[model samples]
Target: MHITVEFGGGAELLFDNKKSHDVTLPEKDKEWIIKDLLIWIKDNLLKERPELFLQDESVRPGILVLINDADWELMDTVNYVIQENDRILFISTLHGG
Candidate 1:
């Protein structure tokens, strides 16, 4: 299955273009979702700060993950059932100046 991954803060990427795309759950793509997401996050955001993931925190300080506009904490998390066109937004939490 194919899903459009849209990062918050104006980032966008597409995946699974080798087969017919649909909204249903693709067994083959399940594991890839979590692994791919971590890879994306690590590569895109923490490339310069590889120690981010090493910290002991639940939600982290500067990262926010939203699935289709809703917080991932409210969803199934990494196991959340994803669909075609589902938007994944990774936002950086902002603090007061």
Candidate 2:
């Protein structure tokens, strides 16, 4: 499946300072969910300080997750099923003033 993954508000610093990625997830026996996508991202894209992005299999506090422009919390958060061409965005709200 093809998806666009984005990071912002300082989260990009942990991903090589790049803000966007076009990812093609491998075919699998089961459908992909946000929880699974998190692992895939960590394994394939995260560059450093994973603790800043993920905590106990989910995003750390102070990060806002959006799916296709909608709040991920409205879409079931980490259990949201992924679909073709979905856009997943992670924006950090933990910035220092």
Candidate 3:
């Protein structure tokens, strides 16, 4: 499955400094969830401090996630089932301006 991942507000620093990435996860027995995707990103895409991006098995405090332009919090949050071609965005509010 293909997914679009976007980073902003300094979160890109952990992802090769790129603002967007088109990732393809191999088809498996089950659908991908936000929590599993987070682990995949941490293991594959993350290039810097893991703690800066994840905490408690989820996004760290002050980091915001949006799915298809809607806040993940309004969806199912970590349990939100990822869809093919979905657009997921992340922004770090913890960074100082």
* Model 2 Cα lDDT, one tens digit per residue, 1-97: 9999999999999999999999999999999999999999999999999999999989999999999999999989999999999999999999998
Candidate 1 wrongly placed segments (more than 4 Å)? 9-36, 40-47, 53-61, 94-96
Residue 11 lDDT (model 2): 96
The order of the candidates by lDDT, greatest first, is 2, 3, 1
Q: How well is each residue in 13-87 modelled by candidate 1, as lDDT tens digits? A: 222111122233345634545445555445444424444332342334565778778888797666665665676
Residue 47, model 3: lDDT of 97
Error of 1 at 68 (Å): 0.9
Estimated TM-score for each candidate: 0.50, 0.98, 0.96
Q: Which structure is stronger by lDDT: 1 or 3?
A: 3
Task: List per-prediction Cα lDDT, in the order shown.
Answer: 0.49, 0.96, 0.94
Worst 10 residues of 3 by lDDT: 25-34
Evaluated with TM-score, which candidate comes out highest? 2
Candidate 2's C-alpha runs over 4 A off are none
Please name the candidate that would achieve the greatest lDDT relative to the true structure: 2
Where model 3 places Cα greater than 4 Å from the true spot, the runs are none
